[model samples]
Target: MELHFMGTGAGMPSKERNVTSICLNMNEERGTMWMFDCGEGTQHQILRTSLKLGRLEKLFITHLHGDHLYGLPGVLTSRSNHGAETHLDLYGPAGLRAFVETALRVSEAFLGYTYTIHEVEEGVVFEDEQVRVLATKLEHRIESFGYRIEEKEKPGRLCHEKLKALGIPPGPQYAQIKRGEDITLTDGSRLKSADFLEAPIPGRQVVILGDTRVLNKTIAFSKNADVLVHEATFGQEREALARKYYHATAAQAAHIASEAKAATLILTHISSRYQHGEEQTLLKEAKEQFENTHLARDFWYFSIPRKTASHS
Candidate 1:
């Protein structure tokens, strides 16, 4: 899976960054893409990338803030204009459905495809055979949320060489063995499926949070995440301002990642006060608390590699 940052600025757009939009590209795993937020100009940003509107299966809004929203109508309309007929699912706080419906109604926008709006609560918002998405309340100025995306464990690859060595010719028995089912040979000999399969591959977990102050629940919510995407809207020295505004500083975000034992920490939603070169300061501060940290830029992509069998 890969995370594509369409916009990374906080509150408003800047010359160096847009607002706050992120796309979780799961095309390789599920043939679909899930978007996190859709700030203004998000459709414009999507035009600059290789992402397709047709593949956008689900959109999860963090909050009702304009910076985190305000682009739903345009994105939906554009998807329709592009002839995307697949259904779309939207998940967000209570007012999200009303806001989206109002915008579409007022603008007289028509959607070619149908969509569903789900008012989320603090629990599993979505689940399928391959993945499960959990939502938890965050300490933001408004009713914001953080999402934990957990990929379901996959079966290990079949040991072709071992089966060949056992004189098991290629047949329907291969599929049975791959499903971890014991099969009886033609000679009435029992074959163990476990002996012909490698260790199971563990699923990956990704945590993406909305704007918020540092909270103990965040650490627990993001435990052992493969990638933790947290907002670093201020520097360490501005902790007072961060707390007052219900935003997190770079160091605080890093501390949460460290406490959660996250594999990688990605900081986004940067304040425009820190210009092009000054972002390094935030990165430096976050690195002080957690070494494996990355400051995300607009259009940046971070790929999360799958865990190996041994690690599982």
Candidate 2:
């Protein structure tokens, strides 16, 4: 899996950054992509990457904030122009459906593919065979939400050596045994798969939060995340302003990462006040609390490696 950061700025666009948009590339696992927050110009950003609109199967909107959703209409329109014919699923808060419907109705934009909109609350909003997504309300000036994406555990490798040692011939029967099926040999002997297979490999977890202020629940919401993507809209010195604006500071974001024991913390949604070299200031502040923290910039993409035993 890979995470593509389209726009990393908070509130508005800047010369260095756009607004809030992210894409989770699941091509290797599912041959599809999932998007989070489609800020203005997000479709343009897609042009700079290898992302294809037709492969975007799901969109998770955190809130109705313009900075997080202004690009939806254009993106949807573009997807149709690109001949996207598969069904698309959208998950968001209550007003999201109304907002999207209004935009499409007013613009008269046509989508070649069918789509479904789901108004979500604080609970499991989506789940399939490979992954499950959970949503929870966040403390923002407006009603916002955070998402936790969990990849389901994968089956362990079959102990081929063990099976061979037991005089089991390798053939189609071995494939069935590897699927955890009980097998009866030609000699009327039973072989149990559990005795020869390793433990199932635990899957990775990713937590991405929307615009919000720091809260104690943040730690619980992000517990054990392999990658915890949090917003640091302000610097440590702007704690007062952060609270008044319903935002979080870099230090506070790192604190949550540390408390949650996240393997890596990615800070984004930077306020435009910090420009150019000034970004290091926020990075420094966050690193004081969480050592394995990185600052995200627009157009930056990260490949999420397999979770190590320590991270698991």
Candidate 3:
């Protein structure tokens, strides 16, 4: 899986960054993409990338803040205009449906495809055979939420070479062997499926948080995540300001990642006050606490490597 940052600025747009928007690229995994937020100018950012609007399957809004929203109507309209026929699912706090419907209504925008708006609560908001998404309340001025995405474990790789060596020809029976089914060969020889498979691969976990102040629950929610995306809206020197605005400083974000024992921490939602050249300072502050911290910029791509059974 890979994370594509469309915009990473906080509060408003700047020359160096836009606002808050992220796309979880799952094209290789599920042939679709899931967006985290659609801030203003988000579609413009997507135009610079190779991402297609039709590939967006789901959108998860963190809050109703203008920087976090304001682009929903345009994205939806554009998706329809582009001739996308697949259904889209939206998940967010209460009032999301009203906000979207009102905008579409006032603009006279007609969607060609159907959509579902799910008002998320503090729990598992979405789940399917491949993945599960959980939400938790976050400490922000408005009602915001953080999401935890857990991928289901994958089955082990079938040892095709071993089966071939055993004089077994490729056929539908290979699929049955991969499913752990023992079968009798035409010659009456028994074949054990488990003996021809490697260990099962472990699932991966990722945590993405909205704008918020550091909280204890957040640490627990992000525990052991392979990738933790948290907002670093201010430098460590602005701790008081961060708290006042219900935001987090780079140091504070790193603290949570350290406490959670996360494998990698990505700091985003940067304040425009810090000029382009000053990003290394914020990154340095986070690295002091957590060595594997990264400062995200617009259009940056962070690939989360899949964990193999041997690695797990």
Q: Residue 216 of candidate 2: its Cα lDDT?
A: 88
| Stretch of 10 with least lDDT, candidate 2 | 303-312
Q: Which ten-residue region of model 3 has the weakest summed lDDT?
A: 303-312
lDDT of 3 at 155: 71
Against the hidden reference, what TM-scores do the models get? 0.97, 0.96, 0.95
Name the top TM-score candidate: 1
Top-down TM-score ranking: 1, 2, 3
Give lDDT tens digits, candidate 2, residues 250-269: 99999999999999999999
RMSD of 2: 1.7
Which candidate do you rate higher for lDDT, 1 or 3? Answer: 1
- What order do you get sorting by lDDT, best first? 1, 3, 2
After aligning candidate 2 to the native by TM-score, how far in Å is the CA of 236 from where it should be? 1.0
Q: Report RMSD (Å) for each prediction in the order shown.
A: 1.2, 1.7, 1.6
Off by over 4 Å in 1: none
Clashes of each: 0, 0, 0
Q: Among these predicted structures, which one has the highest lDDT?
A: 1
